[model samples]
Target chain A: MNEATIQVQKLTKRFGDFTAVNNISFEVSTGEVFGFLGANGAGKTTAIRMLCGLSKPTSGWGRVAGFDITREPEMIKKNIGYMSQKFSLYDDLKVWENIRLFAGIYGVPHHTIATKTDEMLQRLGFASEKNSLVKSLPMGWKQKLAFSVAIFHKPKIVFLDEPTGGVDPLTRRQFWELIYEAATQGITVFVTTHYMDEAEYCNRVSIMVDGRIDAIGTPKQLKQQFESESIDEVFRKLARRATRKEV
Target chain B: MLVFLIEKEFKQIIRHSFIPKLLIVFPVMVMLVFPWAATMEIKNISINITDLDHSTLSKKLVQKISASNYFRLTGLSSSHADAIEEIEFGNADILLEIKSGFEKQLIREGATNVSISSNAVNGAKGGLGAAYLSGILQEYTMEQLAILGIKPVPVIKTTESYLFNPMLNYKIFIIPAIITMLLTMLCGFLPALNIVGEKEAGTMEQINVTPVPKFSFILAKLIPYWIIGVIALSLCFALANLFYGLTPSGSISTIYIFAAIFLLVVSGLGLIISNYSSTLQQAMFVMFFFMMIMILISGLFTPVSSMPKWAQLITMINPLKYFIQVMRAVYLKGSGMGELTVQMVALIFFAVGANIWAVISYRKTTH
Candidate 1:
């Protein structure tokens, strides 16, 4: 039962005269941690947005979480959660309040919300600060809490857009641990990040450059194939090759 | 979906420090400014008393004109020369003068002429003041005729009455309009800014990527504001009732129903503004532009009929104009729902149409 949870076939997005996502295709399997690596404006966020049903592709098609992205956006929305790199929590609200709001928006049952909130707070070691305002929390705690809240609805697929952008390396490590935990619990993690070390933790990774995925493979295979010591070096070599081809 | 959005919205607004300012300051400003701005009672008018006859009759006429609430007597000149001076100086709006032998001629021949000159500035106020001055003169002339043996003159006397506001307190006429303005301004400005503020803070991108429906997101944005608007309207109503004795004379339930419709329409306008603007500054400018146009053309301070045809047509499209007219008509005239049907229809049209447009225009992708 290793069927693809997400399937993209010739997906392309255009804005006016400019193309944001060129003819690109990829598939993510169930319970797999798929890392999307790209620099800024690399179409990684655009591709992820298309998969999350937040954006419509100009041509081609895709299915996300067993639903057509184009035809059944609402159905797909119901089955996936999204955590943006911008950290979307309302800072004025208390930590628990933000969680409750997300839970309610996802239509979680009241009893389920209570238990899930309790479990989440306990897991984050934020039990004592549950009632404290979210703005008062440290950046790392907010990031971790944001991730937990995104997956709180038990969505089958979670799209994370650079979820660890500015966090310290230690916090980044903790974030990967949480991602691994979610994956072990059978949640598919679709993450986009600039951090190459984080790419090593994913089951598979796709590196995008200039609106197209330039490389896709396991981290070890990619490094070995590029004759590189790290994922960063492999990405640099691939990106250079892709740019050289453009010239 | 609406419930979910509204719950989060309430939480967000509750934690906002300036919410109390929004609820209290805005309505109070409206209540205070409405009475000052919206009035037909002529003030600072220049009167030129042309005393061609300088007799007690003409002097008494001048005194009577000066004593009335409407006229602001600029100068009391003895000669037509000085009266003309006051009028030409633009210092006086209405000019009154008694022709020479005015009292003796009226007593002896039972007919005397009094000359009146008006500046005609702010033509409406000038014309109204001129008519009122004629009425006052007619009363004085009648009194003089009674003193003499002017028999069987068949005097047609007029007993003056103010239609709705008998006391002629400007505040009474204005509070309802002010209430409508406060709701519209707050609903239109606050929610428009809130959404853009989220975008500015980079939080909207996060919220946008979520599975939360746009309808729910918009509803959540408006719920707290709608509640705040209700509170503000209530407080303004209470203050008006307590301090100004401004009470809704129509069916209170009907007024409230109309008010609720008006609130929804204005809130819909806010959502539309928010959707069009990508930044808080753009939203504010758009809202301010509409608010100014709405206030100017709303018949709040200016008569809709008095405007040019194109302006009148524009005013008809403005939701605030209809709501203000509805509010004033209901509160002062005790007008029935039947009388307010057109206004109610306009409000409903704006509310439904604007909200639908707002919802439809809100794209999941950034432009």
Candidate 2:
């Protein structure tokens, strides 16, 4: 079996009396598209944040790209890439400038930045938009480019937090192609999303309900096990179970 | 890695074609407007005299008051009530009362008493007016003593030699204060707003997830402001020379050395504010609140000696106070590092403390 790029065991994050993420475990091997799906308050973001070194877990052990999340966050940060739900590109900055900044931040070789940027932009059909300010680009194209910048340094794992939240369908489909391309290049992809249709595209999906992983499986396996025709129906069933448990 | 961040920040600051232009044009506008609009020089104080003495002595006293540059005899009232009314209507800043028997008492006892009423609503103006009036009256009293053949060194003489500004030029005093304020606005306000601006724009989250060291992140934000602040101060000095015919009397390197430390004091303060505030608007208001308090108490417009003891004690922590003092000392007095050791040490403490506080207060983890 491939070594796990991301591994969390009994990871719990509690804010005072409220448990934000309650004792969940998951693992993603290299080059896997893992979808993290949940309702707005279901702690998908909380879990992803713990893995990305942006938030600390309350009491658990987690490792990202073989670095301890609690003890060596700096090492984890160096080995992974992250894209936020909120667009990360600076509107005032030109496209090329933003790429250069992150490339430098990720410790990419100086001699290769220009070539890598040119090749990536050319491949994404963004060659013509390199000099334009990010604000001038459409939302879809911005998110697509943001995804490319996230992995520009070839981190072992990349975490995307709702990367296509407000994107259009066609652009989102185009963005998924980039995700697949990265996955094929042996980069582990951890993504959280609201779109159930997007979850089916993942090699494996974890549905979180009220800070606990209600189910984790391949999309086809979960749909068939739940006797549901689609991933959306399976999500609704788990959501109903969470509310019933609350009652 | 740090250089890239600074380059990004500089790019953002000069992002639009108009921004760099505006940054360069700002000090010139301030130079033209601030000299005229905001000045500590007091002149044209309105005075009303009501003389019931009806004596040549009373008239002579009035002439003496009017001859001074600080006072203008704007009204001569027939009654004390009328003179009080002039003050109430804001037409007069001071009222002089000469008693009916003022000349008889002066001749008989060789001493006389007169009363003066000052509008104290503007405490600074009123206090200065009173002081000027006392100076003039002291001279007049000595003259009376001379006439009485009692010129036996009865008056305490003050031999005055003004330093830095030989003529006590208000511009010389105020120009450095204005430059300090402009630097605060640039280094202090802009960086405060920029940090929170990133939080609002969601770019902070991206930066947070990177391996960017906190110190490097802070220094990167600070570098552009530091560079711009130095340029602005030098340009303001040049403008001070060009427009106001003023130049630093001390070593320019001394001023820059102090300024480099002072910039950290202010910009670090701004960063500390940014770390506390979640929004750019909140950061702005917080910076405004602190800047107002700092500038008002920094002895910019008023002498620090004039404020109440409690207020004076508070000035010790106001970073602008030390900078203003150091700037004026170096610019006007040609004061070297030795004469400025106390202020320099205080500013250095502030710079170190504020930056440590800023970095320590900052959290790498997202909420």
Candidate 3:
């Protein structure tokens, strides 16, 4: 059986009287592409934040890369990488500088950084742009570079939070190609996105509405079960059934 | 990790379009402008006189007062009320009311009073103006006594000694203190803006996910600016000495030691503000407000002793106030560590507390 890289059970999070991620449970196998989807303020961020070891769940339990979410968040941090919705690289810095900085922070050996960066640049076929400032890069190139930096240390899992925001459709498709490549290398890809069609690309998908996971299944299965033509309709149908308003 | 972080920080600072030039040029410009702008010595104080005597002695006194570079006779008031009006309406700094005393009084009694009134709106300006007026009157009295062949009896002489700065140059008194103020501001402001800029760019969120120690992150961010601040301070010292001819009387090492301690307090303050602020704009506004109040109450621009009692009490808690006092004492009075121990302890307490607060306040886990 494929090992469960992410195993979460009844994970819940609350802020005062409001529950942002209420009793959500799911798992993603090794090399699985798990898509986490929700409408605006539907608690996708809060749930993903908990599983990435960046936030503490209020109750229940979870494990990521064999580290307990509660007791070994630091160890978990060492095993996973994260990219946020907003661009996270220093725009004023050069491409190689950003790579070296992350490599250092993630504890990559100093001697190997130059070789690893060269390999990454060669793989991206953009060694010519390594010395250029990140701000001068195209939007699609910036998105691709950010993903590469996020997983540069070879964490067991990498969480992408709206990683393809504000990019053209062709670039968005290319971004997914990168995600698929990361997965093929045995990195668990946990991504949250607003694009409905992208949800179909995941090995397993979970839909969150008003702090609860409304559905979890393969894209074909979710569509067949909801009697819908596409995951978009399934999402819209399930989203309308949520009794609570977006917090 | 620390080395890498520091390298990245320095690279960003250097590559940014406007920051490196600003940091280097800021202190040089402040040193140029502050010594001349921030001084207690008055110049060209406008004066009004009502010389009622119409005699040679009184006319000579008026000429003597007006001839000095310190005073300019703006108007010759015909009556006492007009002279007083000139002072009240802000047209004059001082109104000299020479009453209707003929030159015969000085000839008979050997002494006569000249009624002088000053607009003491700003107490320091008025007090210095009065002192200048007194010096002219004393010189005139000495001249009259010498001319009349009257032996000035019971003459008490004061042989004065002005230590440290014999010339009493205001630049000598203030250059070191201005250095202290400029370093504090630049060091504090740069890191404040920088940390918040990372947050705005969302780079902080990525850093937050790493297992990087909170203390190391804060330290790595502040060290570059701290180094810049110290280097900038040393260059300012050299500039002050070369151009303005102001040098510290105390050991240069002592000033550096104090600066290192004080920089911790300043950079920690900046980090704490950045940790609390969510956006660059928010950080900028909050820092601007705090900086204005801190400088105003720091005794950098004004004498803390001259402030009201409660305000003076408030100054004791201000970190910049202690820094300014230490700088002035060391540079102007050659005050030793024994004299500066209290400020040192206060600064140490602030450095520890502010840095501890910054580390604790930095949210490693997402909210």
Q: What number of clashing residue pairs does each candidate have, in the order they appear?
A: 6, 0, 0
Estimate the Cα RMSD of every predicted model relative to the unseen true structure. Answer: 3.6, 3.3, 2.2
DockQ of all candidate complexes: 0.47, 0.71, 0.76
Candidate 1 chain B: 10-residue stretch with minimal lDDT: B148-157
Model 2 C-alpha lDDT per residue in residues B1-367, reported as the tens digit of each score: 9889998988888875655776788889998789777876678889999999999878888999998889999999999899999999999998888889987877767677888899999887888888888778777876876786653344466899986578987888888889998888888887788788888988988998999899999889888888888989898989999999988889989999999999988999999999899998899999999989999999988889999999999999988899899888988888889999989899999999999988887788854
For candidate 3, give the docking quality class from DockQ.
Answer: medium
Docking class of 2: medium
TM-score of each: 0.88, 0.90, 0.95
Which lDDT tens digits does candidate 2 get at residues A1-247?
5878888999999889889798999888788899999988888788888888888889999999999998888899999889988898889999999999999999998889999999999999999999999999999999988999999999999999999999889988998999999999999999999899999899999999999998999999999889999999999998887752331
Residue-level lDDT tens digits of model 3 in A1-247? 4899899999999999989889988889898999999887889888878887788999989999999988888888898989888888888889999999998999999999999999998998879999999999998899899999989999999999998889999999989999999999989999999799999999889999998999999999999999999999999999897877754
Local distance difference test, each candidate: 0.82, 0.88, 0.88
Q: Candidate 1: where are CA atoms >4 Å away?
A: A241-247, B48-90, B96-114, B136-155, B160-171, B293-329, B333-350, B365-367
lDDT of 1 by residue, A120-181 (tens): 89987779988999899888998999999889989999999998988899999999999999
Q: Write the per-residue lDDT of candidate 1 for residues B1-367, one digit (tens) a residue.
A: 5675677677777667987666787777767666776677776566777676767777777788788877777777878777777778777777777778888888887777776667775787788778888888887888878777585357666778998989888787667767877787887788778877887877776666666777767666656767777788788888788777778888777777887777777787888888788888899999999889888889877678999999999987998888888788889888989898888888899878877777776666543
Q: Which stretches of candidate 3 lie over 4 Å from their true place?
A: A243-247, B151-155, B303-313, B336-339
lDDT winner between candidates 2 and 3: 2
* TM-score for chain A as predicted in candidate 2: 0.96
